[model samples]
Target: MIELKHVNKYYRNDEEELHVLKDINMSVEAGEMIAVMGPSGSGKSTLINTLGFIDTKFDGEYLFEGENLVTSSDDRLSKVRNQIVGFVFQNFSLIENNTVYENVELPLLYNGYGFHETKERVMDALVKVGIADKADKHPKQLSGGQQQRVAIARALINQPSFIIADEPTGALDTHTSTEIMELFRELNRKESATIFLVTHDPEVVPYCDRLISIRDGAIIEDRAVIHE
Candidate 1:
């Protein structure tokens, strides 16, 4: 569902240019759960940002479900992100003042959904994430795992075809992380959402259907695991 051809990303320092991604050619198919593993400064986040259409300043072509995302306009890109992409960050980017319900409903508000539709979508998302009962609680009132679930609920409220998660289990404990990973696996298998996950933990690799390892801005290993 996603393709990147000869993608190159560069940044400028005071006197030197930083090459973040070098000729990165990759493709992700629909209904596939892929884990992206890399060490620090290995361009994992850059790839994620490029795929999410958040960072548009780069070289090469990005195709999303057959559309050339590289040449797409900002308005078009925003629409693609809103309708086709869902993002989950490590820190669980939940609003401090808003309750879980409001946080999940914020995207619907921006998408111009009416009150009734927004309420339905939000409630459905909360239930899907198993956090419907915690809808009225603030972020601080819940545990880290619960907050992450709420964030995932917010992301899923749009019913996007693909999810991009960066360090999804970074802040939670091992047990909580396992729980979150199980939730993600369920979403991938049951909901048929293609997942592009970036994580530094090797322990999370077994949870994914496929694993792609990157080093020095290049993909070194790509394999699909077959479990017994």
Candidate 2:
């Protein structure tokens, strides 16, 4: 569903330019769950941002479902991001004052869905993430796992074709992280949603179908995970 060809990214200051991603080339297929693993400063997150169209200041080609994002206009990129990509951040990125229901409903509202349809979609997403009952609760009232579930629900409400999860389970306990990863596995299996997970945890890597390891802005390893 997505491909990056010889992609490069850099950050520039008045003094010098630092290359953060060097000749990164990768492909992710539909219904595939892949992990991009690397330590801090390794450009894994930059790679994710590039794939999600969250970072557009890069060189080379990024093709999403056949369209070259590098050549696409800002308006087109924005539309694609809203309609095709869903993002989950390590921080949960929830609105503290909004209830879970409202939080999940924001995307639909932004996408111009009617009230009834928005309500239905939000509820369905919450149910899918196993958090339907907590719709009325605020983010602070929920546990870390529950809050992350809310974030996932928000990401899924749009039924996006691609889900970009950056350190999704970074703050959760081990058991909770396993639960979340299992949930992602189910989503990949049953819903056919392509997932690109950016994480540093080796335990989380086992849940993915493929592992792409990066170091110092370069991919050092890319391999499929074998299951017995």
Candidate 3:
């Protein structure tokens, strides 16, 4: 569903230019779950941002469903991001004051969905993530795992073709991390959702269909995972 060819990203600091992504070339198919693994400063986040169109100041062809995003206008990119891609950050990125239901409903509201449809989708997403009962709770009232589930629910409310998750379980305990990974696995297996997850945890790698390792701003490994 997505492809990056000869992609290169750089940052400038006063007098020097630092290359963060060096000639990165990658592709993700529909319904495929991919894990991007790398240590800090390895450009994993940069790669994810590039893939999600969050960082557009780069050189290369970013094709999503056959359209080249590199040439797309800001408005078009925003539209595509809102309609086709869903993002889950390590920080949960939820509003502290908003209830879980409102948090999940924000994206639909931004996308201009009507009240009835928004309500239905928000509820369904919460149910899918197994957090329907906490709809009225605020982010602070929930545990780390529950907050992440809410983030996931918000990401899924759009029924996006691609879900870009960055360190989704970074702050959770091992058991909770496993549960979150299982949730992602279920989404990939049953809903046919394409997921691009960026994580440093090896335990989380096995849940993905493919594992991609990056170092020095370039991909060092890309292979399918064999489930035992």
TM-score of each: 0.96, 0.96, 0.97
Candidate 1 structure quality by residue, lDDT tens digits, 42-126: 9888888898989999989998888887678889889878878888999999999999999999888878888777887798899
lDDT of each: 0.90, 0.90, 0.92
Cα lDDT tens digits, model 3, 42-102, are 9998898888778899988888888886578999888878878899989999999999999
The true-versus-predicted C-alpha distance at residue 48 of model 3, in Å, is 0.5
Q: Which residue segments of model 1 deviate by more than 4 Å? A: none
Q: Per-residue lDDT for 85 in model 1? A: 85
Q: State in Å the error of residue 175, model 2.
A: 1.4
**Candidates sorted on TM-score, descending:** 3, 2, 1
lDDT of 2 by residue, 1-228 (tens): 788899999999999999999999888889999998999999998888888888998988988888886567998888778888999988899999999999999999888888777877788899899999999999999999999999999899888988999999999998999899999999889898899899999988888899999999999999998876
Model 2 collision count: 0
Q: How far is candidate 3 from the true structure (C-alpha RMSD, Å)?
A: 1.1
Q: So what's the TM-score on candidate 3?
A: 0.97
- Candidate 1: lDDT over CA atoms? 0.90
Q: Highest lDDT among the candidates is held by which one?
A: 3
